[model samples]
Target: MATVYLDYNAGAPLRPEVAAAIAAAWAAPGNPSAVHGPGRAARARIEAARAEVAALVGADPAGLIFTSGGTEANAALLAGLAVPRLLLSAIEHPSLAVAAAARGGEEIAVGPDGVIDLADLDRRLAADPRPALVSVMLANNETGVIQPVAEAARLVHARGGWLHCDAAQAAGRIPVALDALAADFLTLSAHKMGGPPGIGALVLADPSRQLASLLLGGGQESGRRAGTENLPGIVGFGAASALVGDDLAPDGPTFRVGALRDRLEKLALARVPTARVIGAGAPRLGNTSCLALPGLAGATQVMALDLAGIAVSSGPACASGRQRSSRVLAAMGLPDTVAGSAIRVSLGWASTDQDVDRFVAAWGELAGRKGFTVSAPQAA
Candidate 1:
């Protein structure tokens, strides 16, 4: 049986070009920090990759700090801040939420649409002391709903707080300009964008801000992070960034995943009356749709799909234990049963119309049991 993967949100397969670049980079036997001829070649690859990444986000290459991945980037950036309060959206990934927890920060609530409430954010900022650091994601990993990061940034700046955006899910799917977004700090993951895993970056618009080191070792990342750089991974990440430009366009939808996704959802709802689309009314990414089939556990749906030769995930990819209601869905005001019923089908660069059809057929068989109600999941 042929297998179809519909979980791109968990991570994308590396592009062929990116894989070739990594192979070529790994063949080189010199550290980027060394000054010998071999070392110079390695350094050149790293610099070129930096340039490619800078171009993708319209950021200065000098402002980018390469790290192992998004988790490390968020931990390092948030752990270093000395603000009076660390305000993070409730819908953020575990990386930011964990960092905020470590710092004893407060969790800001989001609306039923899965977006941060600007008014609520303002209220929190007003009551807190000056120089707060606000952290929010550009697009949510679970729901694929785009956040109002630019407006959040503007409000943070007006109240003398620094804005940090975790663009892990948004970097390759949407247009992300560091200058245009006006965020002080931003984190991105390469694997989320068809690049190799283990290489990601953080961009700080204001380099003058004092950043403390999370690891203690020989100077790397300009002493902001320590340890030998993942040179091959970095090179692959740079090449992937260059590839992303080809996918973006000004008209229609730059990516076609959403159309196919809608077809799957439409069929599921038509066949399985109890089926519901989570965050259907909100704006979502072209590649993702989290659906809830009432009365069925998300884990059951995931297992059913995998057995059907279609791969999908329930909630965050990092989630552990038996699949239950997701914190994100619960925060959006869904009942435990509704949240637990959710399964995510995310398309990627390789996804095709045939894959969507396969998913629609498979979903109908698993979730179309009797007594199910097909309705949109309510947001908090």
Candidate 2:
């Protein structure tokens, strides 16, 4: 049996070009911040990658701060905010909320459509006279619902607040223009966009803007982050971003993963009864679908698909090992039955039409079995 990977949102496989870049970087010897010859060579690679990442999101290379990954970028931003009140969209990734809560912040609500309620945000902003930071995700990790971040930025600024958009999921799949999005700060993860897992960037509208460093030492990342840079990971990420830049140009198919998702969804709906597609009525990433089957636990579906050599995710990968409803779906006002039954199918550059067809076929066969639901491994 052949294996099919449909969980790109969790992490995409590194492209051949990106892998080559990593290999080359690994062979080079030097600290990027050092002034020596080897250091200069490594520094050159870092700057080139910085430019590539900046190009992907329409940011200036000088303003891009490389971090260990998306989580650190988010933490740095949340920790740096000077707000008396910190407000985050309920649908944001756990990293955002976790960082905020660790610093004493509040969670704003989202509508059934998974979009932030602008009016509600306006009200909250009005209630707080102190400087506020409104953190909203550009694209939801689970549902792929794009937020009205530009408008939200306008609203936030009008209320004398700053806006931070977590653009981790949106970076490669959609065009991200910092000036157009009006986001004061945005986070990008290389792993989500076909880069190495250990590297990512925080694109700040102003590089000089002070943010508390999440890590300390060596004064790297322009003192915003401290540590010896992960040079190879950074190089691979740069290579990935450059590739995305080439593919993201006019009339490119960098995001054709969605087409495969639609095909699988159609097949699943046609073959399975009482199956409901979560976020069906909402605007989601083309490659993601959160489907629900009553009496069929998400873990059951995930494992069944895995057993058939198809890889799909359940609820959120971040919520691995737990059998709980998606907080994102719950925030969207979905009932437990719908939320708990949801399994995520996300495709990427590696997914093929046959993968989708196989998933549909496997789902049909499993759903038809007499003991499919009862035999599934319980969430550990």
Candidate 3:
């Protein structure tokens, strides 16, 4: 039995090019903040990586600030902004609303398609007169549903509010133009895009505009994020970003991966009697399929798939294998029966047709089994 990994949303496998870049960086050791000759070389390397990462999203290199990952970047943005209120989409990642009440933040509603309701956003913005910050993810990490970010940015700006778009899952899958999206702030994670883990960025559309520092002591990241940069991780991230730049075309690997996802979804729906998709009505990432089986528990499905050497997920990877309902689906108004039964199977650049075939065959076999859901593993 061959093992198939379909959980790209959790973290994509490190690309060989990224690994090579990281290895090359690791061979040399110098703090980017130091003033010696080695330090100057390190700084030059970091700057080159910065340009690649910035170019990936059509952002100015000066506007990009390197951070530990998406989580820290989001926390910094949320904490740094001096807004009197924060309004986030109901389907945003937990990082956005971790301290909703304490930070004077409230969730904007989303329709059943898992898409942000612009009317609701406008109403909420109009309902409040204070300076506000609105955070909406470009694409959901779980359902992979793309949000109306450009439209939402218009609404946010109409009321003098800044918009933050989390593009962690969207950057490599789709084209991300800072000006086209009209986002004031955006976030990206390298691990989600075939780079090494523990590296990501927070982009400011305005390079000259200053944000408060999360780490108080250093002049790193333009005094915004205070720490010596992770050179190897950043280099790996840049390599991954550059790779995405090459393949994000209609006739590239992205298109083939999308075909794999569609084939898997069509096969699952045809073979499984109770199969359903959570955001089938909405435009979603080409590589993700949030398939649901009405009577099966998501955890059980996850465990069953694992047994067949097929990797999938109940929802967000942050759930960390917990047997709980999905907040994303809940926000979309999905009932517990449907929400609890959904599993996410996300593909990537390295995925293949064989992987899709294996998944469909395994899933169909599981659907035909009796009492397969019982006595399943509790954790991924």
Candidate 4:
């Protein structure tokens, strides 16, 4: 059997267009900051790619700052915004969580469906009468549950607080309009959207808002982030961003992936009566499913599926190689046992019916060995 990769949320396979763009960028020479023919060419490439990435989220190109990855982008925003306090959703990615923690952040609870409790958020802001930054993810990377960012934004702005959204998982998988979301700062990762892993961006909804520079040399990224840009990665990011239009379209690849995801969930649930689909009641990304199988450890399922040529993840790929219960699920009020048994299967732009079929088959076989026989659903 061919290998089926269902770990798109971790890092999607690079698209051919993005690969070609990286190769083209590698062939070119010169620093983007240098004043010369080659340097001017490099600068142009970076700017063009920046525009493409900015367009993906309906952001102004002028406010986009390139960072090493989503981690750095999140850190930069948390630090640069210089908010004395931070209020973050409990289910934020580790990067945001760490950054927020460093700033003495307070955790806002999410409902059992994995959505932030807006009333709790409002209450938190009211309790803390300081100028705080509210950081909530556009979608939970683990459960794929979409957050009510626009509503959160209104709450934050009304309290004279800044709202920063981590849109890494939501950008290519759903409609992520930065202005429409009313986010003061937004973070994105290229790898999450089929681009190179080392590059990402922080988009400012209002370019006039001053963000302090984290790095202090060469004055790159409009003096917000220092260090020479990753030209090849940025070029690949632009290429990937250009391809996201189809994924965001109403009748697009994302919808097809969503159908496959739904099929997989339906079959899994029908086969294993004890299994639970996390975040099923909430609005979610089209291409994601978080499956929690009682009496089965997530790590064991991941390993078994891997042996069967199916690649799935117990949680965020970043948290891979470690044995730990999913904090995202725990935040949603799941018991430790259920959280520990949860695994995430995410589809993407290149996912197909065959890929979904293979995964379902492998999963069913594995479940059967554990004394649960999962029968495939009849084709409609």
Alpha-carbon local distance difference test for all models: 0.84, 0.83, 0.88, 0.89
lDDT of 2 by residue, 1-380 (tens): 86888888889988888899899999889999889999999999999999988988889898899988888888777666566778999988888877777878878889998889999998888887887888998988888888899999999999888899999888888788999999989899999988999788888898778877778776888788888999999899888888776556565555567667777777777777578787777778877888888777888889888989988888656778898888898999988887888888888877887788778778778887834332222111
Ranking of all predicted structures according to lDDT, beginning with the best and ending with the worst? 4, 3, 1, 2
Question: Per-residue lDDT tens digits of candidate 4, residues 39-61?
Answer: 99999999999999999989999
TM-score of each: 0.94, 0.94, 0.96, 0.97
Error of 3 at 42 (Å): 0.6
The positional error of residue 161 in candidate 2, measured at the CA in angstroms, is 0.6
TM-score for candidate 3: 0.96
Error of 1 at 368 (Å): 3.5
Model 3, span 265-377: residue lDDT tens: 87777777467877989999999999988778989888999999999889887776578889889989999999999999999978987898888878877877843332221
**Candidate 4, pairs of clashing residues:** none
Q: How far is candidate 3 from the true structure (C-alpha RMSD, Å)?
A: 3.8
Choose 2 or 3, whichever is better by lDDT.
3
Angstrom error of the Cα, residue 295, model 2: value is 1.7
Error of 3 at 160 (Å): 0.6
Q: Across residues 255-353, which tens digit of lDDT does each residue of candidate 1 receive?
A: 566667777777767767767788888788878888887778888888888999999999888775555578898888888888888888888888887
